[model samples]
Target: MELNNEVIINNLVKRFDEIVAVNEVSLEVPAGSIFGLLGPNGAGKSTTLRLLCTLLRPDSGTASVAGHDILEEPVNVRECTGVLPEEGSHTLYPSLTSYENLEYFAKLYDVPEEEAKKRIEDLLKFMDLWERRNDPAGELSTGNRQRLALCRALLHNPSVLLLDEPTSSLDPIAAKRVRELILKLAKQYGQTFFINSHNLAEVQRLCDYIAIIDEGKILLSGRTDELRRRLQSKQVFKLRVADNIETAKSIAEGLDFIFDVSIESDSLMLTILDPVSNNSVLIRKLLNANIAIIELAEEEMTLEDLYLQVIKEEEQ
Candidate 1:
């Protein structure tokens, strides 16, 4: 049977006094897909997540998770969805040990006793918290606590997962592991994920599709590569030459398509007007000018680039 869209929002809005925290936001997250909500701080990413998870009721709109209406069937929605809020660590009992926390949630989630025991042990070992399993949750390091919180979120294996800043306090290695685990779950278990994150690189790497939200409004949403291709024409390229870097800069500045030429330590930073058509033109001009080119490459277009451009356009 075809699964319904794991999460859906329509004309979703929320407010806190004079501040409109979420303004008529709408989105659809397909089942078994990794969907990322990307935005700057205070841009309503967390608010949207909170609303979907039934923590906060929408002021003027509706949302659903796992085919259950967040407003009308909040209990059903919560039963089918797992959540890791922005302050995920705080959701754990301060006095409960890491294993105890997961054990407690496992009972609430109704995982069979034997299964919960084995699942808890495996998760602790996978997160490298086995040694600290007996330590009180309040005593664990911030990174360890974050891992523990993630473990609790995954304990019941719900159909939909809503994670806000899942790796916020984690170190580089821990963060990477968390990202890897997300992919693993989505692929092996076919779980749908709706994530809120400001980590652009992480989103770029993990998200199958993404939406950029700002000031409680969505700017754009699409596949990651397609979004990057939108700004391909305005790509930036760096040129390095074995000799006569200034002369190369002059050759580039003479072209109408080239602008903002900066000479940096034997290299030149160029803002190419239409890189698809003009990149080779600049290379030809430099080679013809007797500038022994060391390397000429277009800078990788990142989610940061698309995000900044979208945010800037929205601001204007």
Candidate 2:
């Protein structure tokens, strides 16, 4: 089944007495996809998430999760969604066993006993925690505890997952596993995920759509690949030459399309307006002049680079 706006927000506004946390923000998350809410420390990503999860009612706005209105059907919305907050510890009972913890949450969500047992076992095995299922949640290593916390959130088979910094405290290996699991769940169950993260590379790899927000406002939002393509039009290309880098720089400076070229020990860097369709022409022109190109590669801007640029511009 196609996702019909798994999560929707319109004119969302929230405040904390004197400080505005969310400011008329609007966004939509298509079903069965990972939508990233990326921004710096105080970008209001968390406030936006809380509004959708029905944890905190918006001062003014309309939102729906899984077609259930945030204001009109908040209980129903909560029933269909699971949230992994920034602090996973908040959801975990440190004194309980992994299996027992999931069992309790499953019961709270009213999962049938028989089905809950099977799901709990399957999740424990899937997370490679079956052997340690009997262990105390407080005794597990930090990564193992995080994995257990994830299983807790999935116990009721939620249709939509609201994750905040899922991998922030995980090691590299654990983080990769969490990423793969997120993808697997989305494909297998057609789940929709709304993720808040500052890990740019991770967002670029896992999120199909991304929104960069700052100071309670969205700076940019679009398909990840499309954003990169649009930014590609403003990329800088680096050309390493065997020798005569000075001469190559002089030639590059004269080309109008070349925009600006800087010289290093044995390389020339060219910042262009748009080289998507002109890279080949630039290369041939240099080769024809005996520039002996060692390596000509585009130094594409990363999501982090774009994020920093956006934040800096917003500050100014």
Candidate 3:
């Protein structure tokens, strides 16, 4: 494993009775990158996280975290990694005040009293929970409690963070706030985050690298931008015409570089083989045919589009 990789798994497998939860999974998360593990429910996303966090030993396979072997150095692996499981509040004490809950965990992590105080105050303020610092964690809203759980994970300042649905239950506003905080922390601390999420949009916004898993297997994994380009085999464009819609469609379809064309009201949507060089030629040909060009633009492929395409292909 390279030094720049914070986590590496090789053919990691986990089984419960006769069913396999995680089978032959392998991937490497680069240091300081926010990597997303995306899948539908019961797709082994959470199980993979548990195995990496050393909470559940893999039935077979080897992995490492921050240079410590998971099987040989479970203690060091746990110490170097922080986890916010699906039930974030389970790590908190409902009866204990937010401040007290964090303070208690800080002591367990052996963070010095002076440093813990400073770290606690800074984290509370950063998460915008300073005012609720003295209130019992159970009294805070769902979003606030999630923030508090995040603070607890960061109290010890571990090198890697394993977050399972960090913003699962929050409203849009609260979810956006959590996303901003994750970006800010990744930028400021260079922390490597391994996140398992069902929200494709959230993962698209916050993660630079992504992997799609299903049926205890990895379908694909790569840099987000690269995946978008490579997975979308065709480029789609929208071209609006002032007149002669039928004529414009005919011209576009006749072009060798154009693969597909669809007419919509006064516009033509063309799927071209080479959008970068063929667009200008397409417009020139249409204008020459006496079709007035109103507008031309390329459509970007979204994560949702990619996800659906990959999943549908796998099913077929």
Top lDDT hit: 3
**Clash count per candidate:** 0, 0, 0
lDDT of 1 by residue, 1-316 (tens): 7646888899999999999999999999888889999888899999999899888999998888988999899999988888998889999998999999999999999999999999999888877789999999999988888888988988886899999989877888878988988887788789899989887778888998888888899889888788657766676788989999889988988999987899889889987877878888888888888889999887765656666666666698
Report residue 232 deviation for candidate 2 (angstroms): 2.7
| Candidate 1 structure, TM-score to reference | 0.87
Scanning candidate 2 in windows of ten residues, the lowest lDDT window is 300-309
- Predict model 3's lDDT versus the native: 0.88
- Across 189-283, the per-residue lDDT of candidate 2 in tens digits comes to 88899999877778888999999887798888889999767666666778998887887887788788886578766778787767767778778
Which segments of model 2 are wrong by more than 4 Å? 1-3, 241-248, 259-269, 285-293, 308-316
Model 3 lDDT, residue 212, Cα: 86
Model 2 alpha-carbon miss at residue 291, Å: 4.6
The collision pairs in model 2 are: none
RMSD of 1: 3.0
Candidate 3: Cα lDDT at 84: 94
Mark the regions of model 3 whose C-alpha exceeds 4 Å error after superposition: 1-3, 232-304, 311-316
Error of 3 at 75 (Å): 0.7
User: Clash pairs of candidate 3?
Assistant: none
